[model samples]
Target: MSGVREPAGAYDPVDALLQRAHRLGADPRNTNYAGGNASAKGTATDPVTGGDVELMWVKGSGGDLGTLTAAGLAVLRLDRLRALAGTYPGVDREDEMVAAFDHCLHGKGWLPGGEGTAPSIDTAMHGLVGAPHVDHLHPDSGIALACAADGEELTRRCFGERVVWVPWRRPGFQLGLDIAAVYEAHPGAIGVVLGGHGITAWGKDSAECERNSLEIIRTAERFLAEQGRPDPFGPLVEGYGPLPAPERRERAAALAPVIRGLASADRPQVGHFTDADAVLDFLAREAHPRLAALGTSCPDHFLRTKVRPLVLDLPPDAPLDEAVARLRELHAAYREDYRAYYERHADAGSPPMRGADPAIVLVPGVGMFSFGKDKQTARVAGEFYVNAVNVMRGAEAVSSYAPIPEAEKFRIEYWELEEAKLRRMPPPKPLATRVALVTGAGSGIGRAIARRLVAEGACVVVADRDADAAEAVAAGLGGPDRALAAVVDVTDEEQIAAAFRAAVRAFGGVDLVVNNAGISVSKPLAETTAADWDTQHAIMARGSFLVSREAARVLAAQGMGGDIVYIASKNGVFAGPNNIAYGAAKADQAHQVRLLAAELGGLGVRVNGVNPDGVVRGSGIFAGGWGAQRAAVYGVPEEKLGEFYAQRTLLKREVLPEHVANAVFALTAGELSHTTGLHIPVDAGVAAAFLR
Candidate 1:
């Protein structure tokens, strides 16, 4: 009820406001990373005169409040802000309103060297509230009430006389004016609920403002608790037998690629699947389809979650192949329905709308999937939709789910201000959104390939028989989101299968597979044992076959074109003394590449191979003590092995692992888009191994 008295120590109002902003923004239940804002009014020494002047410090637009700094707060004079608010008779365009706010910035009030950052759109409202501190947030509890069918009545009942209620209005000059008018009418109110938007609370200081806001949210939470709704997803918990644990995870993994492919038809996207309790509960509800159609709880959510999610019903026992086909059909229908909705609602003067595609996909019996340009954003979008499910359920439990009107959705979704935010993003890399799996990627040529793929913006899976080595390489390339580690023995079928499953779980699916795992035995034909021959072929020949088979299955199911690459050796094409086992197995691997290319070409899968000669440096095979033995067979000093091979090539340069990786990149980078069933030699121009 009273303002928080200044603390006994040295006090800085700006620092105090920033501290509260970070606290509110850190709690997703209170406000998401960039969703909420805070402001404080204080006195500062006038630059022109020796008198004190009033200044308002509001969170700047487009900065994350959780990481707010002094520079992130835009400073403006209170008198100028009020004057700008008085000029807005009813409504104005986004640019015009921004221009007015920019004009009100005090010349010397900003933090030293802090200029150009625009104040939040709520600046005028904060100025008009006549409070020393103001906080605006889209708290889940407050939004649950704001979106209820009987929102106004519920507000009155929940908060009694402590809060005022304002009807939904687009956030800008007009909304600020309405908030000010409502505040004047209810001078005793400490907080105001913006119907279909969020809530705002004001007080004499940062502590009082945050306290009042939390009190309002607490009231809403209590009201929802009393409604007494049982959890709908208790049956889908970990030990449930309806859909066995392994089968549920497998089905979700299979469905992910299909969902990602549909959502990213025009462009590439990454998908994140969530089986959180709230999501599963929403899916299990009987009125889910109708409830999900009601749209997002707030207008700000429209930018990320979209107006509605695409819902699919896949029975637990349904075959994945059939489910994939059904998903494609349903996705087409969703797009058509979205187009119809736009046509029915577009004003006569509006421009042609962008394609209507869903950002979140809801699949019953599996999970919910969200798509974005990358993993972080996909996860964020999914989190927002999960929160939406909670808010919608809370509202429905008390009464009916009432979202903002469709016209409002259109305005916010197509607004130039919102469109500009997306357009400002940097252009994506060539391999952005694509996922790659590199076998034996713990070191040498395989690790080089993984690093190259990640540098090109591809999410990479580093697979090797050494768990620690694989994890080290993956961590070096990028963290868990962009790079995953899998300890897999290429000779084992089960390990290979599990590795691919892990890849699909980490990223939505794999767009490229580099079968680089291999071994070598440099024994003469007469001295080669059956065990040595089997070991060589098991990795180079059989391993490539199995990895390619799994890659084909996943890529074909996605209905998107992909690439498969094999790391062959020049010995396969050029016979070398005492290279019986190694040469024979690599030859088999190269031929398999051709056969797969012929078979998978119709499915939009490209198969290729790279043959490099004597890459002694940074080669795991050479580093494993093979270099000394190979040098002895060649009658050269161990240190001169690289020089011997370099002199043999026409180009006279020593081959390196990175040189092989570049050839692999060329095949997957779309430069050789039309060329498949080809083997590229990366041996610094080895004349004998050249394809003729």
Candidate 2:
């Protein structure tokens, strides 16, 4: 006990840190997504030396605190890490400090895999702190005071001497040293406000540390509220006011793909759209342009949102064509400025520019659009930008909004430590940034196709008439960020339109669409009623046409080639007896695929078909009595229908939902990049259904 001090007896620093992280991350007011880090100092018995050891556990790189686990904590020997300060080469070569972190890692045998976790660039901030518990957070309220012109005076008024003020320093080893020095000098101080950054708080215990962090955040919030400045963002701009909800959504759907194309010009990217009140209010303000041009005050915000946002120059509800043209013009200017920014600050040692495209885009009346390598990243990026909006609000309310200089942002953005972090990431999947919409996805073949697409790294929109089934499928896929559900009756034009809009709202736009919604009517030629034919044709034939038409509109707007796959039936080619209505409807769908492929190929929208022979095992149509009807016609029991269909094929293998799904994925997964207007028979060698 005398040799090394622990935060508490029988304490698991890793577990306590994770618990505190979750508690803080559970609320948006505490920290932005993946922003902030928590650490705890504790004692561990060294398995090899059989001696007492002091260690620190902090959140590792690229992990969300809300979802953090013991595995996400980087474990380090406190003595070895503290020794890093002694050999530190000073500010000019501060990045070398990060590479040295690996040597300080502990947990070889005492803990499970903690040594494998990669510490982030903020590692020094936690290890160098004098307190047993430390929390570095990006709360909006704290950031507001941090960036105000009178920030030091504001801090003094808010926390008195309980919290101190640290000068502006790019986050690195030097910054950590500055904070540690302040903590040691002001022994009574509980936290420090980092100028042009966020806040950091420490305490003798976890509970006190969390409470102190909250105190700083909430106190700042209360102060801002008491300021009672009504026109902080200034009076509303005339043309920038938010549109009604329905009109706003329509406008966003129209613009999402175009915005996504602009953002993905450097590389493929996924997108997220939000009309949240925070984004709407900020965009409608008269001061929006002046402040947005100033960029973000926090490193966490600018890192994800880029140097600044691209704000639309046109009116919120401008004509579609005019809006598109203006966006292209504005985006071009934004890109030029960003390129100049990179050239101005980049050095021989600097890493190549990551991209010139904007991660955050502000639309006057509609909403905000954010892009990233994936859905969750894009969503979180949007959330961080909203946090920036809050910071701007509070700062303007108190005094003025002041951000870190552009040169400083470049240092943080292009730091060697950041480049190494990027290099550590694994390569993306085959369909990394592709978004897919699978119709009839509530069950059967559509469900399987949705699963396959997500497995290949594509975000999915699960569309079905059954609301409950759609929600269940979406939940099973991951969460809303990965797979979203839409209530869609494909036969209805409005519902089909709504489904695609949901796709755009949820994931920017669609790159792949499966027209799988179908209804079957198995009846003899003598008993084939007019209503039966109408119903089948309406769902299978007309529904595909409508869906394809909408897809072509969106894909052309994006100018990005995409795929439309029709899930036809083998019966369409085989002419199975007593299946006139179903076969006719499917035949209509199959030919439509060929026709649309020829029509849409110029837009690079590939159209294909997958014809499956009697997918009875998991077919929604089969569950609706089509299986029993087909069994009666074939003189087989209902349960033996699969065997009967399998025996009919040359391969004598029963077709399945998975088989149909595999065919869909194969056609659209880019392997057959140029092969379109073709039909792939997924009936286990159904020669009758084979394409000529």
Per lDDT, the best of the predicted structures is: 2
TM-score of each: 0.89, 0.96
lDDT of 2: 0.89
lDDT of candidate 1 at residue 245, scale 0 to 100: 57
Each candidate: what lDDT?
Answer: 0.82, 0.89
- What count of clashes does model 1 give? 0
Off by over 4 Å in 1: 1-9, 40-59, 67-82, 92-95, 100-129, 182-187, 227-242, 319-322, 347-352, 635-644, 647-652
What are the per-model numbers of colliding residue pairs? 0, 0
lDDT of 2 by residue, 608-668 (tens): 9998888988889898999999999999999999999899889999998999888888998
